[model samples]
Target: MKKLLLFVCTLCWLLPPAQAQTGTYKGIGTIVFEAGAPLSLIKGTSESANGLINLETGKFSFDVPITSFQFLNSLMQERFNDKYMKSSRYHKATFVGRIIDKGPVSAKGEAKVTAAGILTIHGVARKRTIEGTLVQKGNNWQLITAFPVELSDHHIQAPRLSSGYGASTMNVSLRMPLSPTDPDPQQIVAVKKFGFR
Candidate 1:
């Protein structure tokens, strides 16, 4: 019995640690932003947002390809990518941070949460504390948040259109459904390539 107990203890010690509960958002996630334009609202959207959250540690990271955003008018889109965002140089915007109110999220109700992290856009990184709602849906969690981003904060200049001037601030919203699973290897590689942990 002593020998058996010793063997069991050694086995447990040598075994690898259990993987943390992680949720990955891919493909289906959406990010929308609207800014006040000269005559109307400048709205854009992207469905290529990707990210992952580790529930156990409250660590999370999200990436958005700058060129993926689409505008209604082709000319507007070109100007946005070329002049405003400089998508050719920046390529992507990313956020890496932790959820402050860490706890088990229940499926029955929504929990208000705050994420404190660094948001990188147009090659500028800024610390931000964003508030959002988290709700469990079946085996997944949905994150919804809306925040205002000042163009000047990231060194982004508001477009000087012929009609007038664009808004200095834009409203950005995100709706992401995260599946409880390990992130794909390719996604991990991509994140690493972009210097995100």
Candidate 2:
């Protein structure tokens, strides 16, 4: 009985840490419009979202409501709101994946990881397989992934363009730097406020 109890206690301690996902992933993620004149746009973000990070296991899940995506430029924001995203129908976008390597990242240090999960748009869920760079500054984990996201994959249609820039895929980029979830012993205060900062 003693041995069995001890084993149970050790296993519990060895298990991965519970999720501490509240980090600073919010940033001005770039939008590359390579279809035409290569227009580049920026979206605004802050340290606000539903994200969970498992420190022990190097796995994480991040989610953002479509309503949170904003652009500082009024005209651009309006255009995005009315056109491309169509946020009303799609309330949120979420990604759940594990880091291929056990990473406690450092500033200027780059590590590659295979983040295979699901991305949801407009209530449609699709598989996501993308590689990303994990940047760590202090305890904050900053993740950036750039990949081709096809609109057609989710029955999504690109907004009608007055100009001829029908690039089949959108070069999507993500800057998710998370700290700790919130109000817990596991809560680690994030350094830079990527989104609001």
Candidate 3:
């Protein structure tokens, strides 16, 4: 009986904590943005946004290829990539951060959450606090967030009248459906390098 009890205690001590047993989720999602112009809103979207979230630690990372964004007007898309965003020089925009709120998310309904992270755009990184909602359905989770980006903050020049483009700010929205899975090794390394662990 003494030996059995000792074995059980040892086994329990070797096991990981419940909080450390949470799964990581990774998936590709849709990202959309809108900018105000003189006559109409410039709307664009991309289905190539990739994201990873570790529920146990609340660490998350998201990235989207700048050239993947599509616009209603091909010329506008070209201008956005070449002249405005300079996608050739800065191929992608990324965000890495962790959730700051406490309490476990209830599976029954939407839960409001806030995340503070670094948002990198146009080769510049800025710290931002974003608020969003999380909803659980079956074995997957859905996260949605909307935030505004100022042109000046990232050193992106405002559109010029002669260029027939004018947008001072861009409203960005992200909708991601994340499912539990083993994360890519490279992605894990990148996330750790960003200090999210």
Top candidate (lDDT): 3
> TM-score-based ranking, best first?
3, 1, 2
Predicted structure 3: lDDT: 0.79
Once fitted onto the true fold, the runs of candidate 3 whose alpha carbons sit more than 4 angstroms away are 1-21, 37-39, 102-107, 160-165, 183-197
Residue 42 in candidate 3, Cα distance off native in Å: 0.9
lDDT of each: 0.76, 0.56, 0.79
Q: What would the per-residue lDDT of candidate 2 be over residues 84-151, giving only the tens digit for each residue? A: 66777776677777655433333466556677778776567898777877675654557676787777
TM-scores for all predictions? 0.77, 0.60, 0.77
lDDT of 3 by residue, 31-66 (tens): 999877546777889999999887667889999999
What's the alpha carbon RMSD for model 3?
6.4
Error of 1 at 129 (Å): 0.3
Clashes of 2: 11
Q: Write the per-residue lDDT of candidate 1 for residues 1-197, one digit (tens) a residue.
A: 99999998788556432212223433258999987754677888999888777654568899999999999989989989999999999999999998876333445646677899999999999999999887766546688889999999899989765567767898999999877675443322222221112
TM-score of 3: 0.77
Give model 1 RMSD, 1 decimal.
Answer: 7.3
